[model samples]
Target: MSNWSIDAGVICFSGVLDRFTVPDLWASLSSWKPTEKGYLVDLSRVERVDSAGMVMLIHLLEHAKTENCHIMLSFVPKDLGTLFRLSNVDKLLAKHIQN
Candidate 1:
């Protein structure tokens, strides 16, 4: 199972980020709007992620960008980072790096 929490302008994710969970994350993010401080998605607690998960993450970032919302990813796990690199999506991911 997977879950997320929204607090202090940050979205914290936990558990596996697979096909099943990606959609749920998408649904949750639909209601998110960036504040002046922007938004951050904390991935420190994310246990795993699949290709679909990665795609969904990209989609979320694209959605945010189109809306002119300032959002980023934080504490990205090594595995996900590698996936991003291998998939040649690291460039897009870089635009949303927390630090």
Candidate 2:
């Protein structure tokens, strides 16, 4: 199971972002508007992900960029960091790098 929460400039998520998790992603994305500042998604709680989850994040990034907003990922696990590196999004998201 997976869940998420969002407030003006931040979006926090914990759980899987796989095929079954797309709905959560959509719900989060659709909540944003062009006028919004941006997003900082906390993926530290998410234990796992599949391609669908990656796609969801990519789409959110596209939306954020097109809207002239920034999207960040916080506390990414090591395994997922590798995935982000392979996907060429290492610097784009987890620029915060607190952990």
Highest-TM-score candidate = 1
Q: Kindly state the number of residue pairs that clash in model 1.
A: 0
Candidate 1 runs further than 4 Å off: 35-37
Kindly list the per-residue Cα lDDT of model 2 for residues 35-86, writing each as its tens digit. 5666777887988887678778778777777888877677766776777788
TM-scores of the models, in the order given: 0.85, 0.73
Q: Please provide, for model 1 over 59-89, each residue's C-alpha lDDT reduced to its tens digit, 9 standing for 90 to 100.
A: 7777777777777899988888888999998
* Residue pairs clashing, model 2: none
Alpha-carbon deviation at 24 in model 1, angstroms: 2.7
